[model samples]
Target chain A: MYAKRIITTMFLVTALVITLPKGVFANGHDLESLKNTVEQLKTQLDKVQIQLKAQEEKTAKKKDIRDLKQKIEQSSIRPVEFEINDSIVHLAGYSSVTFADNDGAGDRFNQVQFSPIFHYQYKDLMMLESELEFDIGLDGSTTVALEYLTLDLFLSDYLTVIAGKFLSPVGQFRQNLHPGWINKLPSAPPGFGHDGATPISDVGLQLRGALPPLGNVRTNYSFYVANGPELEAITEDGEVELEGIIAEGFTRDADGTRVYGGRIGVLPIPELEIGISGVVGKTEVTVLDGAAFGDEPSRRYRVWGADFAWKYKGMGLRGEYVRSTIGEVTASVAPAGAHWRSWYLQGAYQFLPTKWEGVVRYTDFDSPHASEDQKQWAAGVNYLFSSNVIAKFAYEFNEGRVGKSSNDDTALLQMSFGF
Target chain B: MKNYIHIKTALHAGVLILAFFLATAGAQAEKHPNEEGDSAQGAKLWAQTCSRCHNMRNPKEFRDELWVAIVTHMRVRAGLTGQDTRNILAFLQQSNSVARKSSFTKSSTTSESKGIAGIGVSSQDVLARGKTVFEETCVACHGDDGKGVVPGVPDFIDGNGVLSQSNEVLFNHIVNGFESPGSTLAMPPKGGNEDLSNKDIKDVIEYLNATFGS
Candidate 1:
């Protein structure tokens, strides 16, 4: 038993020595000293055991101590079952209920919106992020949909390869600052949100990254090839023609053709970014009326825009202009063959003395070949309780140069929160 | 022919002027307000100390410049030092600074060093070596999760733990040992690992701060 104890002690000591860094030994003879110390400890332990046996005449304390030591030893020697800590999951989202009163049109509180974002990181190389939006109104109408699902693969310091459905990398508002918590205004500028002139997202692969700073300027860029927007037959207003943005986010290809989109931006300074973006796709459309009623061969749809943002101190100013066009679809019925334009400019200021930020914006949309364009002017203020919670109030004036409005103006009150 | 030369020269000068303006503007926006303090420490401080009274925030809650101004205002209220304030700024910028990209010009390129302007990776070697020291020495007392196994050992997983002590305090105590009037059991210098160099200790400290920080 004594020999066996010596063997086991030497083995454990050797294992410990091998595991530690080579530099951890204080002296050349440290190993020898350790062996001698262990031997002396053994002798002293035996002496103490005898003394305890004579004094207490019981092994309760000794057994308890031995059991504890044994447990520690066992735990220490077992293999570490390390959980795969390569990923960090963050759950961030927002909920908002907005009340709007449209001019001339009866006003009512719309839906309660709950959008939840799941951002997951797999080590340093991959990211899987998605957001789901749910809208439930007091009238019992409900809508639920996946807003976007993006998979990003970090290829290099300067570039990332991305796949899956992602926000159109074309403009400032669509790809960034579109989240409810991040958006300063309660509603997107006229002609810019979900029903905007340009498509907001597509399904495809993309490459994006930052470039080395140029002197004092910094630049970032993105390029994508995706299942592009297709011309859809618009049935509204008793119209039957391939129209724009009707099937904008369709993931499946209609004519075995893909669309190309890209954006390039440069920071003229830390406070400002100027960028240009464009997308091109092809689709077939057959207008049953309005001029060319026959099946039109596949035609190319093109969109291009410029956006800029300048922010300093507590003031932010931004604007964007987008133009979309289609090849000879129709002159009367399918106006997409003509030209359409959308543009907006906004300014926001934070009165630091108070937690209130005031904003003013003007947006205009010109339909294809329309004699009159639609325009809106808006102003609002946000009282921030914290970074994640805010209360907002806004009013907007809308007018059509040629058309009629069920609501000529609107006002809104909103409260939004996120975690 | 002479007219063509004049036109070419004028256009070249215009391009140069635009480039110069862009560079100058970029510098204005990319200015690092302060270069002191470490971001890891700032994250820990923000997570543990500031969140004590208020809730934690996502980095995207404010702009980078706004964050700097807010930190400056709160420094006096919170009684934080200059280093602490700067570290917090760095943390906020790295965590939440909105990335800016160059506008599209070229189609694509396969090249080295094409990356995000403000993003960077830390030295892997130092972190790797530091992790070795931690496993060999630190795990014995401050167990795998930096939770204390003994009565006197302090927990390092939570905020304000032994590891979160100011760098100065950690340096002094770790270099020496826990020596105070009311101390029950004192930790040994270098956690009783006599062979550890000052660099080894520093590396381990950095590893702990980076890995377990907020």
Candidate 2:
């Protein structure tokens, strides 16, 4: 009976062990699987963080690039430009090259000229202006000349006081229209040139200004007191007579006389200007046939001029008349009174929207010497490369005394630039 | 002897006249104060005065500082008033800004190619405003007859003239400034009026077409 009971206990224990082991092993396997999943999830989170940081860095770089582009765009619209200060120095002027063929003289590249204008300004009150002309002469020599120099004081809105050598205020040609780039043709009017009827320059004190508008009319004036001009006389064939008037700025007044002159201009319309000019002085003959003279009595000198300019659309019309007279002096080598008279009428027209322009001028010059008198008609056409640059071709028909150089017809081609 | 007497009398007269002018100059200055320059008035003066002696210089030819010197020199040469000088300077400075390349787009290109007007405004008020602006600003160089008064300025009445271009081109030119072919001078942006609005430009373009177009 004992042997049978022991065997039953053993069987019961074995059955219990088998059933509990299966259930417990299953739960342990599930916990191990959950631990593996947590490890994989942590690795994935690390990778995602790295990728997010990279994306954030790239976005920042893109924003930086956008800002740089915006800055470039803003800078392009209005650039930082130059600033002007007080006490400015400026240089401006003109240059010209010409080819000419006269009736008696052969054609050649005869002219090469450069004129430099210097300006030094102190605010709006004062300015020092000077012009220097350099020219290549026929003798292959270079000539340098001071064209004009003046210290301009702006006294008021309407007036300026100018001191030093200044262009003559007698007429418009010498003062306003003599620049190569400004003049439509290559040559000056017959009597408007040097040793001609008009005065070239003067060393003096000048008061110049424009007046306030009177209704529809505007006016301008220039008055000056200067060292008077000197007279030149020549002795030929037992005759002594006045040769020419040296109206340039003289450093010394040998005659101890002063000249007074002025010009008054009236503008009836904005496009039209009329002017009158006059001068009064005493002049003495200082040179006789290119020789010095002494003890010459002073002679009366007078000059009067009238000028008009009208512009309508692209057409311009202008005219000027001048007469210079010297009274007789019994004590002088050339005692006979002499007079130089001159007149010119000019017209210019521009073809709009084109670079071509046409100009015509007629001039009559009469002097005491028959050989010096001239009547001329000048016609020209200009092709403007710019407003300040021009190429001109002109022809002159001249009539003077027989067998005189003044009677020679001429043709000219020129290139001029104003800078 | 009589000539010497005449010279003395003329000298005295000149001195008296100079004194009178000196006395009156201060009064004139006081009467005309140093006011801000008017670009419109300057345009008129430039057209009237510069062409009287020389050809009109393009405003773009010189920088601001250079223009100041040149104009000052011209003031002495031409005997211009101080006010006139300031006004011309104002006009030159306003016009001296450099031109910019246009920012054109494909959409705008397509519309322009199709000849479709963009941002159309047909109001009479806008047209009248355009007319007034043109008269006040452009009449100095371009006459009331739509023909240019100055050399190298385009004639608006010509069928194949500047108006023949597309509206986009015209708009770009008017906004940024333009230099015509073979022309030395360039038309300044907004006709040198910086105060002009984009709408004003468009209206003027329309007016140009309606009035001066072939």
Candidate 3:
């Protein structure tokens, strides 16, 4: 009790001292006031304590004393639970509703999704995180999708490394973060959506860090390898097989590709951020020899792309241009041809700092081999009720076509919440 | 002689280190505000410094209006007199702005440091709401001040150690009533009053933010 009183008095004195005039301490006027307040308050406290003690002695009951002792014991004992100091672990979930339309027949899909993220942190060095997503967009089924699970190692004050399933370091948006359903312009960059063939998440390892080198800014870089997925090529007989083997000890080097990519970014000012990135790699494919001969060897595929992003205050501007090459297709099969280019220009403006945000963007993709181009536009708004909870609504219009004659259009709305 | 001198030097360093730690510990101790500091004491302070020009209503009435008025009033008050009536307004605007202004000496600490997390919440509002909840339901002994005026009336603010709990714990206390003997005060559901939403209890807990949690 004496210790507690002394500490409280000291804090009160310091606070009083700060509130005093510039030379009040030197003039002794401040100390005088503090002394007066302390004396008066202490005298009053003593009287109250005496009165309380007298009352307690007069009406002391054995049951009451026993109860008081028990209460203190319960309150003083800490609960046994996993805790990182005072910070507690919590389960966070994010999801959004999207309505999409494509200019064509009724091939457009509209749906809602829930992506739950579990994150655990220990001070500044380590964090364990995993995400699970439920999508009703494709086939309208709830499939258990492993988003990413990783143990992030903060290697230095400015750098970090991760060895686990994580995003492929392909572009600024694709690697470190994803555009929110509402924060993105009407349409995402051409090759980023669900139907796009580019990879969003990869099972691999990555080393990324920032350097406050020359210039009036901090720059960053990332290197990563993507664990490719299994894909098949159709044969004359409509059969699918592994794509790289041809005969005894014969192969095409078309096995699953390892994705390699890096990014460079600069924080010119506290509120302004800019970054650019690119990735290249060959992905495996199962090819068909013919219906009579069955499926034969695989084919090595290559994909490469670049992107740039900028954010200032509540406004953001982002764009990415990518080209992928799928080398050889089949024996006499027409070549998959030139670079398949995809790009988009997007911008967002938040109403109040980061609480409510608005976005609009346009995207288009032209396949080197395909006859048609896919294009889209999106506009949306997001409302952040708190730091952890948010509501978003967006409308997207999509179009896919070769000439002006045959094209597809789509629209959507989304709301997501996560910490 | 050289070895002895080295040992002496090491001893001197250790003593200096120990003294530094002691001083810091003492400083920290002096800074911790007591949870059980009398509300009447706060009320007295409020009356003397605050009541002079402003109206004294139930804290609920002053909730929204008081903040804009207080923040603007405090600057002029600071310029003119003592402490600018700075009485742990943690309960008023949950964000500790005054504390930040005191600690952040550097000019470049962006507005990002002043998060909206603790904005617009005050302890008095929480206490007033907590008291109302306790009263509408706990009429028998735990009287208005949350100090249980009668025998067995668990003083929510003091002796019962309720005020020492985190907002969440206090929330559970008021939500899930005490069923055991030492906790005989039996906090009915929402302190017996079913009308108060869980949000009400959260506000009360936010009021107690300075009490239980750092």
Candidate 4:
């Protein structure tokens, strides 16, 4: 009887479930509405997060721009340059060519030259200046050489340290003057240009700067130390001959000794500059084959020099004097004491209206051992197309102390351009 | 001693040259316009005027003394006044230095315009309105010599007074009249006459530039 009651109760409950109302458990609309509400909440949260990310990114980008601007401003305070990676570089250039006629040597194309200048700078403290020149060689081939490759460390306005190959400070022409565009004439003073009396380049260290001005007058100085030149002694036809070979560029020291040199310049007025320079050093050379087969040791290549430059109105005047004393060679039987002297004077007048400049120069050189005295006079005119281009015509009259005045006269024409 | 007594003799000649230069240039040091010039203005003028005819030159092309003389020499041909000459010198000096320029372009341009401010006046247009009105009306106190006649008057040739002001400022000064507390004299409206029109003021500005700032 109990089992039968249990079975009846189960059947009654099952029937009650099947008979429930439609609204009691809610329709599909309510379930769909709840799902839409949840999806809407998720979309709103995503929008808010995206907006926040955009604001953060915008602030970061603005900071990056500000940093870039500050870096540019700081870099601009130094020498102007264009950046590549970690280095900054600048470009400059010079060039020249010439046609020459000589009484003894006949007419010929003298020389052609092109030079490019480069400057690389680091921060505001260090710098490198390089110049490469391509010149016509004796065999009519182009020869390349480094004019100067200097490294500079800026110490202050009053001091800068320079090293590597540098122009000699003993003569202003070798150091401060002689660019094709800057020089008014087609040629420089005799015995003062390349391969002349003074060595043009030195591998050395130098201190150079302009001193404090006195009134409106300006003053500058350069002090240097370098490997000195070489002096040679030879025996020919029972006579002792002495010679000085001035080689320039990066090279090993000939005598394994250093030279001390300095230049002091003063401008009493803005239009004039006066200077005194000197050098003291050791020089030694080995005689190839002679009565004495050993090296001829000469410790003294003492030099003294003076120069001046003045310009008034459109006229410019410049002059220089250099003297050298070579010590006696120790390996030769005869005492080979040699003294060398050179001097030149040049004047130029520029016609402002036509951009034309007329120049005249007189030069004299005395070489020891050869006992030769040479005198030269030159007259030239320059037609400048612009500041960077010039055409020059010049005539030179040369006379040795022993030869006729007309024996070695020459004429020259040249055009120069720079970018 | 060296055998070339000529070098010693030439040194004597060098001494003579030094003496002569000292005598000539001792008190004869030239006063350049660079000392008082506004370099910013000069650079702008150089870019605007000089670049019209040719490419620009590097300041390292000449020494300061040579640059001064060159600028002064060209002034006569170019018709630039003392003020413009000085400004050019200042620009060159700052440009030539390896270090940063001591005097930078002003951080804020007090009188500069934002965009294409000045009218595009061609050479012919400027020449048409050249110094006729200036000669007839402005030459009395301004002087026929081009310098200012009065002590406090505007020196058009030297970039003084109205010449120093911008085009808009100068125009307003002329149109509305000007009287400064520091100055005793007063500039009448429309340049003290009934003949000057608004176009006349433009002509005078062109005349000033052509005569003194070219």
lDDT of 2 at B186: 80
Superior by DockQ: candidate 3 or candidate 4: 4
User: In model 4, where do residues sit more than 4 Å from their true spots?
Assistant: A1-87, A233-236, A247-250, A286-294, A332-334, A369-372, A401-407, B1-90, B93-214
Best by TM-score: 2
Question: What CAPRI class is candidate 1?
Answer: incorrect
**Candidate 4's fnat?**
0.01
lDDT of 1 by residue, B134-175 (tens): 876666445567764322356677775565664445655665
lDDT for model 4 comes to 0.62
What's model 4's lDDT at A224?
74
* RMSD list, candidates in order: 20.7, 11.1, 26.6, 17.3
Best by DockQ: 2
lDDT minimum window of 10 residues, candidate 3 chain A: A244-253
lDDT string for model 1 (A77-155, tens) is 5243222345456666689888888765558886479998777755435667687889995678788888788786544
Q: Per-residue CA lDDT of candidate 3, range A241-267, in tens?
A: 233211111112234335455566555
Clashes of each: 15, 0, 42, 1
- If both were scored by lDDT, which would come out higher, candidate 1 or candidate 3? 1
Residue A273 of model 3 has an lDDT of 45
lDDT of each: 0.62, 0.82, 0.46, 0.62
Candidate order by lDDT, decreasing, is 2, 1, 4, 3
Error of 3 at A52 (Å): 13
DockQ of each: 0.03, 0.41, 0.01, 0.03
Candidate of highest lDDT: 2
Please write out the lDDT profile of model 4 over residues B113-142, one tens digit for every residue.
Answer: 321134236366655664776665565445
Sort the predicted structures by DockQ, highest score first.
2, 4, 1, 3
